[model samples]
Target: MPGSLARFRACFERSPRTVVLFVVIVIALYVGIRDIAGDAIIETLDSHYPANEPLRDILRTARNYHRHPVEPPYKDKFWEVGQRSRNLSRWLAELNGPWGSQLRGFEKERLGTAIETTATSLFPFLSPPPPKQGSKTPLRDLQRSFTKDSRGIVIPAGGSDLQIRFAGHLIASLREVFGCSLPIQIAYAGDSDLPKERRDALLSFDKTNNTEFLDVWTVFDDATLRLRRKGWAIKAFAALASRFEHVIVLDADAVFLQSPEVLFQQRAYVENGAYLFHDRLLWQHSFEDRHEWWKDQIKEPSPAMNKSLVWTEDYAEECDSGVVVLDKSRTEIFVGLLHIAWQNTWAVRDEVSYKITYGDKETWWLGLELAGSKYEFEEHYGSIVGWEKEGSPDDKAVCSFVIAHTDEKDKLLWYNGSLLKNKLVDPNGYEVPLYWMMDGKWEKGGKKDMSCMVGETRRRLTGEEISILQHSIEAALRVDEVIASMKES
Candidate 1:
């Protein structure tokens, strides 16, 4: 030991610098190893391990007490859409040049807002403001109790018989999947269009006093008001503006095969005030699409397209209004959207200039485009559910297409068990089971080939539901016949 110590002392005395460098390097190497190996760990240790027994028990217990954190929803989407609106605004400003947006503003004067206002004037709901804040009225039910939070599910109806059928399917699915656990508000736009029997049948889904109807067709007058009145668009705005702290806006024709409770409790919904889906159906539009905000005041690029410095080809889009979650906390955004939608003006195109239109769908997006800078907008880029064409690509456009998108993790998009027919796809691009036609009939074993599938995998129809569906289809057929006769006359 004395000899080894003597040797080490002699080396250190000969080169103190070398010893210092060696010590520094050794310490650095240890730190490097620890940093590289530390936080990269992804999986939990095996629960069966003796050391992890306590951790395993703690985790299992936590599952029982997991309440969703109150957070803002879809910060990502709102940020992204807000950014896009900025870019679009800048691009428009650049195109307009010295005259700036002023030149482009001429189109608004020509046809857009005036046309939309005139068209919107026919409906009464949008004209009258919702009952005053903190006041009791027909629309506002302040004393109503709630189970989870005071969130309302709103389905806007277009008074189509197919809408009635789909509403039945949606309500039935909700009952089975979500246990019929929501205060659903049905905003009916056309009472005269809906038959007494069908309306009665729709009301029957609410045995638990969870369903309420807002008569949309009745044109109530507010004599005290001056300029113009509100209409159908107010249903969406009023739902958000009314007592419901949060509202899920849905199209009557859209169906939910699974429970959307997961969506409400999601980080995106809890965190943000508004949740919106991207406009997936942005294609060269036509009037038959029924989403005609573009015709109100649309911009067209000039004939000298390549040479012209200012290029305006901006057209309106059909923002998928089928599924929207509104948070009343986002007062600015909600009120802004209401104003933009109710503004009784649409975009149009003339020979010279192109202007932006304000269709219901267009107005929603426009409100976002304008308000993105002022408010937070959360846009989602996942599967969407709405009216879409299905079955053979060769067939005519399929109407009243039904689809749903649950969040990931429980993202079981299994359609019709394990059936996929002839490259059939659902509205959200997921492959769905397709039915075949044989001897002039859909071979799904129904009285008629009206539907493509018989049952859903997660929540299949019971005998009673099947009977209800059959009855609904029969009633729908009768309504169709009546419409056909009226048209022929």
Candidate 2:
């Protein structure tokens, strides 16, 4: 032990830079390990180590603490290192040993601040590498093209004439009902997806022309990605192609009760840089293939996976992608988005993701989890908004295809079936349902595979909610009227 100490001392004396780096790593390890183990190990150490024990002994014991069962299974070694370094500043400032305790409060603060600066300075080297998607537009390249200061809404539309109509109502609700002035980008794969006339109609949604049309095929190389001219798979790729640093990707059929702009201020989105809504808790114990596929795909243990209902509750689905909020400037979110784009790319979507999950929905949260990106889902599961089946038992589910989501405050944030009773059945209809049902424990699938709310709980919208919905419906109707007029012209 003395000989080993002599060698270490000699090496440390000969190479001061190497010694400094070694100390930083050990201190960082202490900070990270302590956080996971919490006060238990600290208390244990305080009891076990005598006050007269050497500082080296205390550190060696602390280093051994990582072997405990509490170690976090973070796959990215760089991320683990960065996390360790980042926490060192606070740990050092709060250091309370004989020499450290002698430091004044201000002195400790200054020292902590310096450590923090050094830790952050190392971040460029420690940051997680962009995911290797092997796409035409790599995440690193796309990140370089990001408009860091811009924020906006992006809707992947122009898949069909019907989708164009749905997007019209969505834009109207955003501008007329919610009074949101954020620039709206209608993202399409090519001119074939959205013709000139359709582009003009979408642009007309906002009188000030705050809307712009994005041909994603032109923005991104389609040879490698093969973005379909029409499909739900285009959604994630559209978000990646968008120039905005902060983006809200809304489905063409999505209708909001409140301004989606408020989502930017949501505590979840503010902290995590990605906010997603939960899909209805359905298909439990079904889709074993999908469950197994996810298990095989996510080889690394993840905290996000632990929190997800897909794993914890064994639900087949979790995220509803109708309304997705993302801050692309964040490395984690950007990388996660890239993973989502890769998942939805032509080959992967057709061969794996689509076969496992119904559409592009499940891919959202799964990709984020796979990339270890921090994301928050709406606290509540989706609610059904439609007519309660007449003559059916009180406990029977509401017979509607609409899936509505609520915020932390339990207020209806948005619903995804559009204003019509059934958009596919009656495109021009403006009938909006009043009663929204929740706590749907049982879902009965129709021949068309549409899940009906057959649960035993129901809730009527408050007068304010109903009133706002009515105004939103009215805004949608006006958009319909304008589209009709444009067609006549």
Candidate 3:
């Protein structure tokens, strides 16, 4: 090796220019090889973490452009080489070794500026100039109203007649307990088409409550239009429904344990859009089958369309779709996207279609992203309050207030029993228990507690109440055990 080194040194000295040119070529090849290797590494990473496809693709494309200065095919002019460089710099800084430490400081300064600029383009409204510090009198004076009127109809679509009757009974119980005058309208749209008797039932329910009956026929051209068609119609309806200053759309199986007005109050902050209680689990399931489609969909910088934009949680996390609140202005945008998504859904079936266009929740998130609308997320509204496999102590905590119930009859009974036994509602038309808001457990010099309590006279338990509560608790425990076994399987 020593002799070879001496011979090579002597040859180089004799032809320095030739040696220098050869050296340049070698350096170029090394850089080219490194670049190729980096691309391969990125591709491997993407395969492992497919959920981060958009971010991964963006990084890869940016790296490619940097290694070989070529214009990308996409029209997102905002995603340029400079942005890619910033991202690469950030990624490198998050790694180990001297290169990472050296790049960290540079990334810190550049990342802030890059992120701000990128966010401005993606979310222009978020850049609105802050108002001068002053009393929030204008905001406070915006006469926001959240009244619980017992005036709406409840309609069941896919469940059995017993289920329909049970739903009706639950609605009736709520109306009686909460002094809500809203009449629930019920209907079915299973294998059989909308039958005349079902139509008559809906009409009768509507007439009795002086409210309008809404059927699948009224909402969609055809109820059995496949998944894509159904999704589109639902989106369009949600958007149109938003025109009402306060409109709610819920799945039929959901039971209302307490008034929904509480959700409305929180939704008022969303000036341009509506609030949604999203279950992270549902979001994951919605995307699990459509990983490829999602990858393609997120090639550009889309804060709204990106699932990573939201926080991730465990698989056990569940969200309830029993309730949704929408402001009128935002609904129009959702409706427009619904039409687009419906078209996409019809074009294909299976994983891609389902991931890219099916679920209303995804469309809702994407629509919000595209429209640049603000939304408030309510965790309580999406909670699985009563159906834990292990009868968690946390379940007891849920009994404090009015919850949108999603459990079966047995679980409902358990919840009722807990609420009744705990006396979460005090006498005197105020101080109702709420999981989000404790009934009367407010500190003297803190935020004022805002819950209405039922009078003491209604606190006395009747035989029917006692029996229902007991049965519900037992059934709930059994259901939990069954669920636990299923999870094990």
Predicted candidate 1 versus true structure: per-residue lDDT over 1-489, tens digit per residue: 999989878889999867655555565556645432221111112221222333233333222122221122222122222333333333233323453334334432322222223222221234433443222222112213212247778765445554664565455455544475877776654455455665666666545657776543332222311112323344444354344567777655443434555556655566556555433222233332222322222222122222211112221233455666666544344434443433322211111111233234444544543344232223222232211234654442222232223443434221211111221232122232222111111112222222332212213234543343344334334444544454476
For model 2, how does the per-residue alpha-carbon lDDT over 153-223 read when each residue is reduced to its tens digit? Answer: 99989777778888998888788777898999999977888889889888888876799987777655665
Per-model C-alpha lDDT, please? 0.39, 0.69, 0.36
Global CA lDDT of candidate 3, please?
0.36
- Which scores higher on lDDT, 1 or 3? 1
Superposed Cα deviation of residue 345, candidate 1 (Å): 6.8
Among the numbered candidates, top TM-score falls to 2
CA RMSD of each candidate after superposition: 24.5, 11.5, 20.0
| 286: Cα error in model 1, Å | 13
- Relative to the true structure, candidate 3 reaches a TM of 0.41
lDDT of 2 at 84: 35
Those runs of model 3 whose alpha carbons end farther than 4 Å from true positions after fitting are 1-163, 166-170, 182-192, 202-208, 216-220, 227-245, 267-272, 280-319, 330-360, 379-382, 387-489
